[model samples]
Target: MNDSQALGRISAVVSENDVVLFMKGTPQFPQCGFSAAIAKTLSQLGVPFTPVNVLDDHAVRQGIKDYSSWPTIPQLYVQGEFVGGCDIVHEMHQSGELAQLLRDKGLL
Candidate 1:
């Protein structure tokens, strides 16, 4: 797919899923450390999320970066909102903020 198509696809995925993770690989087999960290955090929180494997699609990999303007993978979206990447996720997880957010969203 092209840029516009990729963007459209991403928007649909985020809107359709209550929780979304645009990462390098599936939750079962993350391709990178950062992706793994975020996936683990979400799993540990018992957050039911849709994992978008960017590695499977070139357009999606670049599309997600452009879509979020975050220049990173493992981007988290909760209730269609942009949550940050690995370090931010890790910090939040450690501080219990991640769990709190999930609970607030009825995802935990």
Candidate 2:
């Protein structure tokens, strides 16, 4: 698929799922440390998220970065808003902000 097509798919996934993670692999078995970290964070919070494995599709891997204007795997979205990548998520988790955000979004 072209960039636009890929973006469309990404967009659909984002909008359709209240919590969606565009990552390098499945949440249960992430390929990258960042992806693994984010997945673990969500799991710890008992948040249910739709995992979009970018490794399975080149278009999506590139398209996700373009779609969010954030160059990184393990991109997070809650209630259709771009949250952040691993480091940001880590900070939020440490600061207790991640749980708050998830609670505010009714996902936690």
Candidate 3:
């Protein structure tokens, strides 16, 4: 897909899923440390999320970064909102804020 098409797809995916992870690979086979860390955190929290592997598609890999303007992989979206990457997620999980946020969204 082209850039515009990829962005459109990303938008659709984000809106359709309550929680989405735009990562480098599948959750079960994450290609990067950051991606694996976040995936593990979510799993431990029992949060059901959709994982989009950017590694399989160049346009999507680049498009997602542009869409979120975060310049990073493993971007998390909760209830259609950008929820930062690994370090931010790790901190939130440690502080109990991630669970709180999920609860607030009626996701947990």
List lDDT for all candidates, in order.
Answer: 0.91, 0.92, 0.96
The positional error of residue 50 in candidate 1, measured at the CA in angstroms, is 0.4
lDDT of 1 at 1: 93
Question: Candidate 1 residues 1-108, lDDT tens each?
Answer: 999999999999999999999998888988999999999888877788899999888999999999999998889999999989998989989999988998898888
TM-score of every candidate relative to the true structure = 0.96, 0.97, 0.99
Residue ranges of candidate 3 with Cα displaced over 4 Å: none
Give me the runs in candidate 1 sitting further than 4 Å from their true place.
Answer: none
Give the Cα RMSD of candidate 2. 0.7
lDDT of 3 by residue, 1-108 (tens): 999999999999999999999998899999999999999999999999999999999999999999999999899999999999999999999999999999999999
Which runs in model 2 stand beyond 4 Å of their true positions? none
Could you tell me how far off, in angstroms, the CA of residue 68 lies in candidate 1 after the best superposition? 0.8
RMSD of each: 0.8, 0.7, 0.5
Greater-lDDT candidate between 1 and 2 = 2
